[model samples]
Target: MSGADQHIHIEWRGGTCRVKWWSGEYLDNGRKRYESKGGFTDEEVAFNHGRDKLYEIRHGTHVKNRDGATPMSDWLDDWLAAMDHGHLTERGYRSTVENHIRPYFKKQNASVADIDVLAYRAFKKHINAKMKKASSAANIMMVLGMVLDDAVPRLIKTSPVERTRRRGKFVKKPKERKKDMTPQAVEQLACNARTVFGQAGYVFIWTMAMTGMRPAELFGLTREYCYPNWPLSDPRPDDEETERYEEDVERYGRGDNLMPAIRVERQVQYADSTLQFFPPKYESCRSLVVPDFLAELLKDLLASHDHKWVFPALKGGSLGAVNFDYKYWRDVADGADERSGPRTRGARPAIPPVPSFKGRRLYLLRHGHKAWLDEDGHSKFATESRMGHEVPGVEGVYSSVTVPMERAIMKTLQERWDRLRGGSSGSDA
Candidate 1:
């Protein structure tokens, strides 16, 4: 074919062919672009490859050429440095790179292009061999995907994670099943916490159960954000509570039964023995309504403490989960069992002496809160907001939290509080 009619030109070397083609368009600056691909056994195959490359560039599907020869470790370091640190905690970033990414990639000296789906499969197998959690494995895979995706055309042509179909259905691994706690168990645990760790633990456990706040968010709470009688932000900051309450009534059309609310905007995390405060997970900044009883308790608790932290450590600093769990939660959880009684002198407590669920975690209280909200028929939007989770899909976009919904949540929490106190039912506010 003539050069004008032929989109691709091919030339044969000893055993291979080289193909060249115009990208078929002028760039925005009126510059012509061409492409070349080689190493095909036949001229036709080389031509087809060149033609496909031209089409990709023309269609804006081409990955721009960048440095692809960097080692996986070096690439990861650069990528991590360039990442939006706000999106994840420093610990999370370090954990993924150290515990997951490097361990899998460092063993191989191969470039990014040499890593394929089989490499990923082997990495997953290695993680599984170590008995890692399914969720942890999944997260590692996700991080790898992110790296490979960003490495396109520069480091690798396409992602090597296989997305194959079986019988017209997409293949997917089953997620790990997290245990959920019941509201009754939550109440019992909270009471046990009170007895074991004093009033601080009691209020902390109850707040988690009632508000569905993440442990980090709960720890991040400050008195200024806890509006026991009004919204976190009064439209008129200079105005009195009565004036702001009246404004809320007019704006939100709320009635007399308004409960307390907490603003969730920050979280505290410990990385490398350093305590740092950051934005809430997924940046899910929102307000949560609390029961009147909880509000009163929180007010009293805040009044008693002179520190900025709502739940300060015993020695007056940030409370770390590791210390909290070992010192207080383990003992309280053990004491919840009827089988666990007074310890004998000079004897170690019976290992697993409690017949009851001895391994109750603080997070289970958050799960219990969500369950209670579901049981009380709170709107999905309100529940997700309270739980610090973004509602998925169109419903999330359309639905919003309303005063009535908040009122209903407060009413249910109040009812649960009464029931916990051995009352038959709760009276309407």
Candidate 2:
């Protein structure tokens, strides 16, 4: 071989044959680029490999040397920096990348080009083995896939991750659904909370179970958003809110049919030791109808506090994320053991556990509320709307919550409370 045919070269190394192929490209300094690989035992095999490299280079399928050398950790940092996410979302992404992605790739010393199908599968196995929940492992894998896909055609030819559809009878098991709490169980929890953290705790548990509001939403609730007198004290409507106000007034004008409600506008998020208010998840800003009893309960609770938050922390101010779970909720749900203090002056009573709520999360109240709404045979549109979830398709656009729908919800919820308290269904307890 000579002249242009000499662009592909096969030569003997110490103990093996090596191949070098011209890439048919030029550098910024006007020099020809060459790609090479070695360690082939057979001369013919090395020659064939050189020819294949030449073909790939000419077809523009070759990965650039600089891109292939970029480290996985550095690439992930760049991708995360370019993302436009809310404070809370960005914090979560950063946590996942730092805690899982960075460490694994750093240990393997992986580069952008190192994540092929086998490497991706191995990483998935590592994540599954380390993570306690299948859902958490899936989320980590999704983030890795996103990072790899973003490097396409530049750092990588294609992403190694592909979503596979599970088939046949022996498919991957679904996550276990959270258990729903019965009305009696919910009341027991509320009662226990009252004993442990006072009246505020009692009201907090009831509000979550009845309203189906997210924990963040409750943490962010303020006097302006909650209304025991509802439409009577509702703020002046803006141009966009005019039609809603008119409809509300028409439907709830009579004193006998007056309904109380609360507005869901924002939620509290804790990050970097600071509390920030952000729009509700998916921006599902809505008005939620409340039962008369709950309305009165909220009124009394608000009257007792001058703090900005409706459900202030036991020590006052917004509830801290860690403190709420460790100091307050654990004692309330799991029960506290009798203990003696250092000076024997701080001795406290042992609070008995709520059997039904033991080992459960506070978020389960929201789930149980959905189950209750379903049990009561409420319309999908109303129930979903109340839960701050968007209804999809034409049904969402066409169907809306009418006065009768809200009234029925209010009546049933009140009845449920009354029944649980051993009072007549329609009695004012």
* Candidate 1 TM-score to native: 0.71
Cα lDDT tens digits for candidate 2, 1-429: 655558988879789977878877788999888777889999898888777766666677777667788999899889989988777777888889999999999999999899999999999999999999988999889888888889887788788987877777886657655655777777767777876666788888989988999988888887777865445555654688888777666554436667777878889887667888888888878878888888888889988888877888766788644367777788887888876879744666787776666777888888888988999999999999999999999999999898899989988999889888884333111
Instruction: Please give me the total number of clashing residue pairs in predicted model 2.
Output: 0
**Which candidate ranks first by lDDT, i.e. highest?**
2
Q: Against the true structure, whose TM-score is highest?
A: 2
Candidate 2 TM-score versus the reference: 0.80
Candidate 1 stretches with Cα past 4 Å from truth are: 1-66, 85-94, 164-184, 227-258, 271-273, 336-357, 392-399, 423-429
Relative to the unseen true structure, what is the C-alpha lDDT of residue 25 in candidate 2, on a scale of 0 to 100? 77
lDDT of each: 0.69, 0.81
How far residue 328's Cα lies from its native spot in candidate 2, in Å, is 1.9
Query: What is candidate 1's lDDT per residue for 111-165, written digit by digit as tens?
Result: 6766788887887788767655777777777777778778876567678876634
Q: Give the lowest summed-lDDT range of ten residues in model 2.
A: 420-429
